[model samples]
Target: MSVRQTRKYTHKFHAPTTLKTDSIFYRIFQSLPSTFFELINQPASLAQAYQFSSVEVKQLAFRIDGVFLPNTSELPIYFAEVQFQPDKKFYSRLFAEIFNYLDKTELINNWGGVVIFPNRSVDTGATERYTELLNSPRVTRIYLDELTAIAASSIGIEAVKLIIEPESTATTKAIEIVNSARQQIIDAAQQREIIQLIETILIYKLPRLSREEMGKMFGLNELKQTRFYQEVFAEGKLEGKLEGKEEGKLETIPQLLALGLSIQQIAQALGLDEQVVRQAAQPKL
Candidate 1:
């Protein structure tokens, strides 16, 4: 299976800590209803997904991982940031950048903002700073790890991974979730993506499982032909186009990069060799 190219900006934002956050965020966004795009004035399908800005605010230069602008003339723009660590200054920096964007854009309109944290404990900002703002209803903070009421729906399974648990339990649950997802999803493309996601999770949780178990888990042959598998292949085509071989880079490279895939993963996603991806990573000059 080929790993596709993600957005160039994605390369700037990856790390072990962020990978889990990214996976969950991507899945959440993917699973949202079509009306979500309508709410944000975005396209209906997941085709043209995210618009990332390395310099969301000049001088301040915040990298926005995902953004969705309202289609209606009157609605406010939505700014989203994903944080996996516990930083005390999170809100301080967040509001600073937000006001900077508001001032720079001269947006004399209302704005909606969301900050997603892996778990409630990861949020270290002073509640006092956001007390009034939280009361005002324009901002929301979500902690993925704190949600452990009961699994009323399938989405609840993804939510459990955010919890701080023994590696063994997490691995067991992840395996259960993947098995369930594979059996439940009929769409080949979506099913493939789910399996890929499961594999990615297992790579991190490998310490919890025996080497033989891990190998057996990933040894399946059907993984190479799933929709998720093909998408990664498509990413390679994008990398080629971006290199000006056949398709335009603007259309291809940035698209894959935007998906936040790793260079190696992108290479695999596209069915290209690692050397090709490494070469593509270099500047035009």
Candidate 2:
């Protein structure tokens, strides 16, 4: 008898902290593109005139966490970087990605850069070499910890601040944000999205807590009892049953991939195995 051989496969289950933070920022930008302009102290109206996206430099093998492209040729494009950890060579890498993007695109427009940090403590990246660029108006650095004073009035800004909130008080802050969302946001879907975002931020902040525990801490139980929640939950259940089909789930992989969801997030949201999602996400010849 001939000996049989089998292939072995290894799977990467979790996303790194940096990737998670990037995803959160991506979601915030997607749901509320205005928030980016708000953080940079620009007119929030500008967000309506621009579309946000994540860009990849295929040849150079670099990916920008986020980019805002203007609808007209007059406005400058913005490159956004969310740096939660310290990296000495961050500017070197950032400028490389920015210039490469400029070379690759045919669009002719001025450009700017925005770097977001939790606080000045983690903004340890060396800027000596790029001091001129850093000092120019083209670059904006936002520290989340310094924005707490404005969080009370702005739901989007409050959500951003929650990312750096301390463990002991994160839950309380989350509840306050949720309540504020209910009162301020008249749209039911928007309200749910804000609440869901708050839940997600807490999940990243308190990794040790189970989803059930986090849900309770955020008053999800009470929120779920609301009419809007019931409607959304019921619609979700119906959609889940329909998408439960293998073909339906496969069709969704590309859409989620386009939205910049990580394999882990796509798997969790679609009720599919990570390896399966990975395989589906791979490009075909």
Candidate 3:
């Protein structure tokens, strides 16, 4: 008789801290890429000529969080990294990835790097090897905490700052950002996207609170009355109804979930019952 053996295995789920922060930065770049150039003290107009993206170097198994590529050779390409935790080898890894990308692309234009940290304390990366590079003008480092001292009227900057705002004050800052976006952004669609971004940020920041509670905390009912929100939701609802497909409405739940909205909120937004939304949100496996 053959001997039989049994093995037990356990799995642990780890919430990705880097992914959370990176998602916020990616969304910011997607919605308002100019805010990035603004943060680096560069002309915001530069954003107009650049499109932001994330790049991966599969050969070395390296990935860059963000890259702003110029439309032409006239402008330098930008590499952006959001570092919330301390890593002794950050500069080494960053430079390696940057140079690798440059080598792979064979671009002749100059390049710049921007690193964002929550504060100086967390920027404990070893820099002895890259001292000259770090000291050069090609690299820019931003401490989010330092940004609070300057009073900026730009809605984009305000939204960026809200990410590092303390929990006690985050709600207040978010309301201000929403109101500022409403007044500053003339385009209705753009204004709504900004508001949605703000909502997404708060959802990540305050995960303990239910969506209904967040809506109340941020005075979302008042926001719903705004023309931007009304128009966007009305269009979505009309499109779904016209298709006469329940799946059309359900498809939005995943997006809302990705934005940190709870199933209850998704249900309310889609005019569906909680069970239906919950079922749709479940993993197919």
Candidate 4:
């Protein structure tokens, strides 16, 4: 029987993690460390979950997506702000929260900053307070589009391409990526994950593709017919049956042998050694 497939997300398609959006962010930070945030005391490392508090009494907090602790053995922490959208109040809220966190943490030392925008145009209407700060040596702002000229040099070209692709184009590109990755990845589990990611990115781009159509694009139907898939399922159903009877033990022996296990090896599998397996192998003797 054919299973009916359903499309996952029907509304508000934000870029999903399966699209490797977060990984793209990390790649950017890795390549342009100075542009996003200074390394501070962190020597070539990215802080995934950073913690900071604003006021001791209020307990203000900021959980930065990425942080670069000072490398020269400094207490001041450098925080990275990666913004994929054009939020007019982006800087306003960012500094307010960071300062609040500083107060709460009682962190009194040199601090560095970075703010990344998808493109130069997205840097809209910064407050005068932030304007001065943006100009400060301690803070750096990066525009991903501005760096497109260097796309060839980019380690995250796939991610950069994702930003530029239209919905239709994205689906096509995603299919190609999924196909390429499908061949490149040898591990079945990992290949499955990437295939799922491909589907997710597509669904995130176009909510209209029905799950059935999506399955066709990713070749899921073809995968279901593989011998490996059938065997795993068939074995799963027989698990309990195989565990119960003495006949089941006799039955398991030849199957194990058919699977290239020697009698001794099959004996080991059933928790019996050479002698027990040999006796089980003999009929009525």
Candidate 5:
């Protein structure tokens, strides 16, 4: 019997803390700190005076995904966390970590926090104890579903919203962001970075797609040349088990379809003819 192992997110101090979406959020904040402020209804100009960095609370059970440190002592430090999984103690634990970090640093600045959730539902509602803090402006909880609430004029903000877009329309939105990023971002290197960021988001959202297909979809000749895309493609190995029996491959048609893969793509990945994949997609008589 084959045992299926499920990867569960944990709060331990030393586990594999790299989440699928964590790095994407981290990059967006570091490259575009202005977008981080915009997410919390702050003026984009505030970013000009702050530098962002990820913090690790030494020997602690938690980590701050990102922190915005002000150049001057006048502004408070803001920490950011991307929480997709539901952990009832998330907020409490975050507070502990933030305090721990503050204790270590000699800088005497006030601090605030931001947590990004997919929506209101994913956030555990065990906040009765911290009602004052929760209601205060210091803690900003962002619900990604309500994209309209965000004044998404900047390309960075646009990329952040694109991460949570519905699958049916995500491709169209990704393409639009790519075009916008290319046209808006002046530097060639920055343009490629933003475009690659968008591509990375789509890859995480739609893992079933192969690199070739993704390149064609984005219409970028340099996409496949990017190191991130190559690494992700190798890890996913959509065409793994090339030697498996035809019947086994046939059984995967429905699963692939459910993952938003087209019949042609499925057949190509499985090394089977399109006709056979099409036939497998039909209802069994």
Candidate 6:
């Protein structure tokens, strides 16, 4: 993936704790930069114009990571900062790093910055020295909790919102998000990434829940692709088992029964009447 160069996705938000919320946001940036652009009130298509990566300011003894560098020099480079905990020096350090990188780098592109906090309250960085920069278009500040007016549409944005969702409703919301991802995203790999990302977020949100329990909440989309499921579905016509004959179909009913499908489900799947499925399900003498 070319980092931030992806499509636009919009959705409303509402929402975690320690266990490194910043890293979760980092994962979001890696997997779905569209959500970041949406958070900044930019078109999701804009992500396609930028590449995201980290920059090392060797002289400064630090690295300025999480940057969105436009493909063309005409567009400004965006510095992204995710702040999960309150830091009094956050803005000072942010500006310092940005200016330092700008000074050393040959790229003369204009620069902007965005600071993302879990909520407004956690954004306690002292802005006195950099008030002008902080208040201008050069910088965009996002409080995830305050995001509103977005359509309930983009699965990408919805996944971002999962970070702050309350523990009580997180699982239910996760399931909904997983289903939406499966339905809306056509690309198989992207769909799996979204599903895994959602599951990762839930694992963080509800740490008490077991992985097995969490796996039950979301079908990973690989089941239907397996040979076992292929035979079980059998085109819902008892396909491939006992081919082209009623006896073959009847014979497979025992296999389906052994596989734990109920009589009605097997009947519906095989296009057989319930009584016939029941008779086939009976122990052979």
Q: Judged by TM-score, which candidate is best?
A: 6
Ranking by TM-score, best first? 6, 5, 3, 2, 1, 4
Where model 3 places Cα greater than 4 Å from the true spot, the runs are 1-19, 58-62, 217-285
In the range 1-285, model 6's lDDT, one tens digit per residue, is: 111113311211222334455556667777777777888888988988987778776765666558888989899998887777677877776777788788999998998888877788878989899888877899998877776567654777777777887788888888898788777778988777777677667655666765335435644234334334454465656556545567777878776555445677667666789999888788868
lDDT tens per residue, model 4, 1-285: 000123211111144323434444454444334323222323322433333221222332224445555434355576666565566766776776566555666446677766656667767746677667878877777665565454233213444455446775776776676676556657776556555544444555565665335434544233333333245446554345346665666655544444444676566556556786776666653
Off by over 4 Å in 4: 1-58, 61-78, 84-86, 106-111, 153-157, 179-198, 216-285
User: Which should have the higher lDDT, number 4 or number 6?
Assistant: 6
**Can you tell me which runs of candidate 6 are displaced by over 4 Å?**
1-17, 220-285
Clashing pairs in 5: none
Q: What's the true lDDT of residue 139 in model 4?
A: 74
* Candidate 1 residue spans exceeding 4 A from truth: 1-24, 27-61, 74-76, 105-109, 155-165, 207-211, 215-219, 222-285
Q: Write the per-residue lDDT of candidate 2 for residues 1-285, one digit (tens) a residue.
A: 000124211211122232256668778888888889899888877899999986765666655558998999999999888777777877887787788889998899999999888788878888889999999999998888798666434778878878877779888898888889888888877877887788777756766654335434444334454343454455565356435897788776765555345677668777889999999998988
- Shift of residue 235 alpha carbon in model 4, Å: 17
Q: How does candidate 5 score on lDDT?
A: 0.71
Worst 10 residues of 5 by lDDT: 1-10
Q: Which ten residues in a row are the worst by lDDT in model 3?
A: 1-10
Question: In model 5, what lDDT does residue 253 have?
Answer: 72
Instruction: Give the alpha carbon lDDT tens digit for every residue of 1-285 in model 5.
Output: 000123234321111232366678878887777888888888999999998875555555444557888999989999887777687877776676677889887889998988888778878857877889889988999888886765446888788888778777878888888888767878877777887788777766776655555645543234534544456546644345344788778876775565446777778778899999999999888
Question: Would you estimate the TM-scores of all the predictions?
Answer: 0.55, 0.68, 0.69, 0.48, 0.70, 0.72
Give the per-residue lDDT digits (tens) of candidate 3, residues 40-108.
Answer: 887888899998986666665555658898989978999988777777877886787788888877678
Candidate 1 to truth, TM: 0.55
- When summed lDDT is taken over every stretch of 10 residues in candidate 1, the lowest stretch is 1-10
Candidate 5 residues lying further than 4 Å off, grouped into runs, are 1-19, 59-63, 219-221, 227-285
lDDT of 4 at 225: 36
Error of 3 at 84 (Å): 0.4
